[model samples]
Target: YKAFEPQEARRILDKLEIHYTPKHGSWLNMAEIELSILSRQCLDRRIPNQEVLKNEVAAWQDKRNSISKPMEWQFTNQDARVKLKKLYPTIQQ
Candidate 1:
């Protein structure tokens, strides 16, 4: 995957009309975090089959939805500029 050329990937995406995040962007981080939480809370144990897994995940989702609140994201662009400075390229003026 790492060996794949960015230009080739971009060409494919352009052909497919797919939008993408910039390199090193945390666009998928929140969903990844949620999956981690779900794994810890409900999926850590081995389930015998897909049906059991589905039921367990559904129950977990119901319980989570019942108690869920909107997330207040605190990381601003300025915060990202400071914390993830290396991830961004310097602008030429």
Candidate 2:
């Protein structure tokens, strides 16, 4: 492979500063997201009875499991800092 250019070097440096989130660290968030999707896909509809709801949920779950879809996480550290600025303490200059 060819050597990295100046801009590539800068990008690498920026990546080095990014906060690495542990895979297990975001399991709760992942579960919530999956539940939200499940709600939108099937639970949001009006079910006739408990039996129908159970079948619908089971069918939807089987359909989901049939395909292997990986989670695509696009949130960056900069996004977290911007969206959750209130949670982080500010430094007095």
What clash count goes with each model? Answer: 0, 0
Please report how far candidate 2 places residue 71 from its true position, in Å: 1.2
Which digits, one per residue and each the tens of the lDDT, describe model 1 over residues 38-82? 999999998999999999999999998898864557788999899
Query: Residues 1-93, candidate 2, lDDT per residue (tens digit)?
Result: 157888998877788865555563386787788799899999997899999999999999999888868677888888989999998888999
**Candidate 2: pairs in clash:** none
The whole-model lDDT of each prediction reads 0.82, 0.83
TM-score for each model: 0.57, 0.59
Q: Tell me how far candidate 2 lies from the true structure as C-alpha RMSD in angstroms.
A: 14.1
TM-score for predicted model 2 compared with the true structure: 0.59
Q: Among these predicted structures, which one has the highest lDDT? A: 2
Question: Candidate 1, 19: how far from true, in Å?
Answer: 15
